[model samples]
Target: MKNVAVVVQDGAEPFGLGSICEVWAEPYHPDDDNPVFEFVVCTAEPGRIEGGSGFDLFVEHGLEALETADLVCIVPKLDFRHNDPRAVAAVRQAADRGAIVSAHCTGAWVLGDAGLLDGRECTTHWRHADELAATFPKARVNPDVLYMFDGNILTGAGAAGGIDASLHLMRRTFGARAAATTARRMVVPPHRDGGQAQFVRTPMGQTEADTLAPLLAWVSERLDEPMPVERLAAEAHMSPRTFARRFRDETGTTPLQWLTGQRLALAEELLENSSLSVEQIASRVGFGNAATLRHHFAASRGTTPQAYRKTFTCLEEQSA
Candidate 1:
């Protein structure tokens, strides 16, 4: 929220650490009005830290830096399988006290080392998910998601997933506007649902003629309209069966699943930024009715539309 401590150890992956810094350590810009964190790069043993690459870094702060941090972030390191006891203890202590503790990629190992992953749903890079599961049998490892939160602990998948995770935190803490501002400055998507898959089975189509992006964009604009598989396939100029197969191959989710997620996301934005009634929002997002919207909200967000609106509407109001 305010103070962020990114824990880096020897053999740290530069990109993971850099992503954390980019998200939390950005300087204030008058035009952006985003939260400016007191970000510190700390280590268990502050001094020369070897990077995963050939480069090196001279870190100044030690574990003490985490004592007052609102967020404790564990950066991925090459030596993930082996966690330093001092670092593990610090992270555990931070989480025990209710600070938001997050790890990116193989950084989940440190949380595992601290016994924080036990009985909690978590994820790492797909390549290391099985290893993480094998190493910590008690942890419920879900390798498919880009990122997930089990209480105060957040785990992100791989390298680029760090941006998704960090921006998500920004959105949760500050509001969607602040997160979008930060993301705009960083040149990244404002939000990618944590439930999104880490990888699709096939490479995304590149050309405008080949890609489904245009169709997706078209659907996003007309979410309130009925879009059965037949309708969508007709719009895409393909058979329903082929369209469904291509959709799964490209998006890693079924068309219905994708539609539900998009509708929910649109509903959230409307809840925060618009003065629409719940029924209106439900209709606009294609949930059909307030009851349907509430049903999906309960199943997906674990909170009712009124409660979510109250929470984020206040944030938006305060920001305004």
Candidate 2:
């Protein structure tokens, strides 16, 4: 069995650490006695580490365990301002000696700090994309995706993106079935394509405060028409300024940002599932032109719509 080591610090997030154990350390199944990994969750002190949201974690191994690990994982911390070089060095050293180094969420910053992300493809929580790119200019930051795996070095966004990264690692190591089994045990999708964009801001028409959902549905229906904010505000029954503020509050972004995201999603679907041309897709998604859609897709997805479609487009029909 390949050995996996998860590195921890004083202020690591529990979800990331717990995800390491949940997917890597635990047995794959009771009846299936074949186990794929011998996992270790190690920290500097092998004791208690405080986490975000006031949770405390206890472990039994320390940094010494990292030397023999086939894979090393770095989990997120409560504070991003201080990622000790000692921890970063250990991970770098492990990677240098042929162990795959995997960092989840904000842990990508540590790898960047260790200088491993230079000229490499990496990703992190969308909120930290700017800071990460500015801090490490050589590192290519792709903010639109769920995760990016460049050879052995892997990164993920915040929240449950850690799970996506973990499953990705499993897929490469054990095969797609093993990855799917582990994801089922954890109740997560095993393979959400890394290219999928992050959450978009929209006046979701749904009643779940997705004020943009309805407007967006309405917009999709009328792709030939301009989805101006004033028109959308009228649909939402609020003044233009008030509607914009409410949309931002509910979606963590502006109406235009949300609209652009929806258009991008539509473009991707049209590219992957349909045989639509770039200009046709642009018009269908409301960008109305290939050039305009290309600019927005590049801005929002960090890749061109043509490239995305070429990479992700399905070749055949699915069972479902």
lDDT per residue for candidate 1 within 200-227, as digits (tens), equals 2212222232468899888888999998
RMSD per prediction, one decimal? Answer: 11.2, 9.5
Q: Native-vs-model 1 lDDT?
A: 0.86
TM-score of 1: 0.63
Report the poorest 10 consecutive residues by lDDT, candidate 2: 198-207
Q: What stretches of model 2 exceed 4 Å from their correct place? A: 28-34, 193-196, 202-320
- The reply for model 1, stretches above 4 Å from the true place, is 193-320
Each model's lDDT comes to 0.86, 0.78
The RMSD (Cα, Å) of candidate 1 is 11.2
**RMSD in Å for candidate 2, one decimal?**
9.5
Clashing pairs in 1: none
